[model samples]
Target: MPRFGGPEVLELDRHHPDPVPGPDQVVVRVHAASLNHLDLAVREGIPTLKLTLPHILGCDAAGDIAEVGSDVTDVEVGDRVVVNPGVSCGRCEYCLRGEDSECVEYKILGEHLPGTYAEKVAVPARNVLKIPTDMDFPQAAAVPLAFMTAWRMLITRAKVRPGEDVLILGAGSGVSTAAIQVAKLAGCTVFTTSSSDAKLEKAKALGADVLVNYKAMPWSKAIWELTGKRGVDVVVDHVGEATFKDSVRSLRKGGRVVVPGATTGALLELDARYLFWRQLSVLGSTMANQREFEEVMKLVFMGRLKPVVDRVFPLEQARQAHEYLGRGEQFGKVVLAIDTPD
Candidate 1:
């Protein structure tokens, strides 16, 4: 969006030039781009972020390759692909061990670099994946950031075991929805919370075993009681200040809390006794590395893990799309359809 502050700051710049592929990058004709909480944070201008005024905002994109860079050899023009938003320095120590997200230069699309709100975006060739012919563009767009983040949080950081209990906070958001399914697929008993019953019902359809409305009762206590006071094996939380304390309380001894963001606010006053006495692990995570992204997406492509897309807005209505997500009404991802230019 042009300038940062609120949804009102979003501008449709029709005069924007189509991006050309760099030597190691390829240009995709973006058919769809999905929204994330990161988009909201960037639009409002996170303190550490310095933007160049006019910026396009979107992280997960799906489209066809319009042009391939001179050095690119894997995928060619006309390939149907989904963009992996994480960029990293391939020579770094973390990157060598396949931990691209931990690389010294690691950054995400729509965050450090130009993003995918436009009809075309140029990104590293290594960051694109070929999609099945049956996969729709909007579905592909909805899969990247949320699924990637949730995969790393539940699968890697928390190390959720089969038949274990996983409490996923904020059932309505994209990450929580994905976490519910991931936890269930891992054979974990999934517990999720939402303010709305409709969203809770939807979470059930996604295989969430226990659903709680935090508005009706304190979710930590509910989870505590549901698990017979044993607490859960793992807690997946993105709501930092509002729920971090409760998350720790809801975990059993040796349990781990995996987090991908702090939507409510980051500063948390955690009880040290809960951590030390309980031997709980608090793990911080971000977007996935390439291998993690591919692993989760394979499940998505096979129909085992579905991408939940709440709504789709045309590029011209981006402002309204941002407003909708800001209201926190969507149960999953809010997508933007990239209308082809005449």
Candidate 2:
């Protein structure tokens, strides 16, 4: 709890014994965690996050409970649960509308608040979703962030329909992987792009109807040709500065582009003319609302939607995990295994 800078700022040390649960919270011994590009950005200090120094930096995690607050009843100590991560005040206009992601005070675990990178984490009771007995911690940990995000974008925002063509801009990311599976499950034709053929093949295995090698094609012009120049119904563009313009071009007139994050860079040039001329709709999205989280995770639990995990690191090696994700070569989620009770 000392530094506030880079990965170097993430020094591990013992502060106290077990964390006490708040009136509406529970304490859990973290068993596993997963990384997102967001963690890297937080470590690098995103000015907008406005984090307190020495903040923990994990967003997705699962573990067995160690203790529960006196007021809690839905779960008990020893219950296995996945942390939802999204935090929002209960009474905002957005929350009232069930769009918790748009809450005026919306924040996420491991970002605006302390994260689950450590051996232990205390979270609001509302944040913990019970997992089926057969699911492992690593698998459960992968669901919250990526699945929720894809659910929000594909189902809620874009309202992607069956047989429609959907182009996912980045094939290697966790969200992209989830989108590929979810889009296919929704009976949509899914197209994904990856720099590596191996990753593209993996995307194909995960139900991608077509794979685009960005390294080979250079632009999405081929996507147009692949779709008979009709363009896709939706484009999931999180690659940001590098692919934003082409993403606009890859879509058909009135097509929707749902963006969750901009890994490359946030600032990008936009052609307003294209927006009006094509009657295109640019939709922005983030994590899902509570109902979306529940609906998407049900599929994960039932084995209908799968999470592709690239690798797992021990908690102490978070720095190494960050380095692995930094290479941008991983094909899916990178996880961290936190040792705890069964």
Measured by lDDT, the strongest candidate is 1
Summarize candidate 2's per-residue lDDT along 1-342 as a digit string, tens digits.
355555556566666456789988999789999999998888888876676675787899999888899999998998999999998898989999998899999988888878888788888899898999999999889779999999999998999999999999879999999999999999999999877899989999999999888777765878989988889999999989988999999999999988889999998667999989999998999999999999998899899998889999888788888889988889889999987634
Stretches of candidate 1 above 4 Å error? none
lDDT of each residue in 1-342, candidate 1, tens digit only: 767888998888888888988999999899999999999999999899877868888889999999999999999889999999999999989999999999999988889888899889999999999999999999999999999999998898888899998999999999998989999999999999999999999999999989899898889889889989999999888989898989989999999988799999999778888789989899999999999999999999999999999999998888899999999999999999988753
Candidate 2's displacement at residue 143, Å, is: 1.3
For candidate 2, the 10 contiguous residues with the lowest summed lDDT are 1-10
Best-matching candidate per TM-score: 1
Worst 10 residues of 1 by lDDT: 49-58
For all predictions, the C-alpha RMSD in Å is: 0.9, 1.4
**Residue pairs with clashing backbones, model 1:** none
Shift of residue 49 alpha carbon in model 2, Å:
2.6
Question: Which lDDT value does model 1 have at 331?
Answer: 95
